[model samples]
Target: MSTVATAFADSSIMLRRNVKHTLRNPTTMFNAVLFPIVIMLMFVKVFGGAFSVGEHYIDYATPGLLVMAVSYGLGATATAVNDDMTKGIINRFKTMDVSRGAMLTGHVVVTTVRCLVACAAIVGVAFAMGFDPEASALDWLGVLGLFVLLAVGASWLTVAMGLAAKTTESAGLATVPLIMLPFLSSAFVPADTMGAGVKQFAEYQPFTPIIETLRGLLAGHVSQGDAIAAVAWCVGFAVLGYVWALSTFKKRA
Candidate 1:
């Protein structure tokens, strides 16, 4: 096999290894999937009425929660990456002449898949809770595209975090900001409803544009500017994270 083909083959093996680990370790599933479902239920059942946003609170909240779900699920990826680094797995791979990039690629791909699955769960729960979207076929496509982009970008960033941490615990802790940033955005409430400083911050923060773009796509009235901003942010994250991850892996792995 050519070098590129060899790399792809090795990466596939690594991906399967990670998937098996995810299956055996239900805690990762709990963190990536179940926890988000519980949070969605709480928001819709417990606090939906108080934070009414023009439409059924579910409609307004689903987009934000979807982003939140993606953000929240990434901690598992970071810790998993850290585990491989700290557990002598990298040393074994080195001895085996495995494509160095394959290991990280496996983590990134698995993380993205986990995020997609978590988002699907959030959407399913939203539907059960009467969350309705007026999105067109094209709008749904846009939403899917955005979801993939966000997942890939965030996965790369988390992989980099995993590579940089000295321990799995710290790797998990490094992702706290990822889990918390959505709360500061227009996820549950409109940025405009926030106080002065917070409102300004929420409006310009990366997550806000992404959430707003999603909200618009779902509502059938998305702004062009917000869509552009959201795409740019995703691309920026993917680039930054890819570079950071590759460099860190080279240095530390």
Candidate 2:
């Protein structure tokens, strides 16, 4: 078979395995759906009064929580990759006739699907909480595009972590930064409200541009600057991550 055909087959098999694993352990979906909603509710109910930046806290928080969900999902992906490595599954695959890109493509595709499902759940919960998108369908599509790009980049980074981790525990622990980044960005609150140093950092951070781009897209505004920045960050990260992960995987193999 051609390399392309082999890669396609390998990716399909890996995707099927991931889907079955997710179905068997429904907790993965449960956490992906619930954790962000819980955080949204908690923030709105507990700190809404203190941070009265908007009429409805949930409305203001929807985008941030959505991003958080995507970020947190990377941890689960990392853990799974690490487990596969530990069990010699990756090594076995390496010795097969699979294409070199198959492993990375499979994980990235699975992660993208999970990201879409989690984003849909977040939108449902947000709507239930009276959070509405003021943007048109095209704008919403733009936001979804940005999300897919971000997920692909993040999955590569997590794959590298999985390859580099000495243990499963470390692989799981490496995701803390991913989880915390949204909070530190313009996600929960505006950067201007933070201290000067933090605000400066937040303004330039990757997540800030991503969140801004999403918010603008969802709000029906034309934020070209933010849009450009978001795309730049996503593409840059994806390329860098792909290079690093491929190098690491080859070395380890």
Top candidate (TM-score):
1
Error of 1 at 3 (Å): 1.6
lDDT of 1: 0.91
Stretches of candidate 2 off by over 4 Å are none
- Quote the lDDT for 194 in model 1: 96
**For residues 89-199, could you state the per-residue lDDT of candidate 1 as single tens digits?**
998999999999899999989888888898899998889888789999999999999999999999999999999999999999999998998999998988889999999
For model 2 the local lDDT of residue 193 reads 88
Clashes per model (N, Cα, C within 3 A) = 0, 0
Scanning candidate 1 in windows of ten residues, the lowest lDDT window is 47-56
**What TM-score would every model get versus the actual structure?**
0.97, 0.94
At residue 216, candidate 2 shows an lDDT of 79
In model 1, the runs with Cα more than 4 Å from the true position are: none
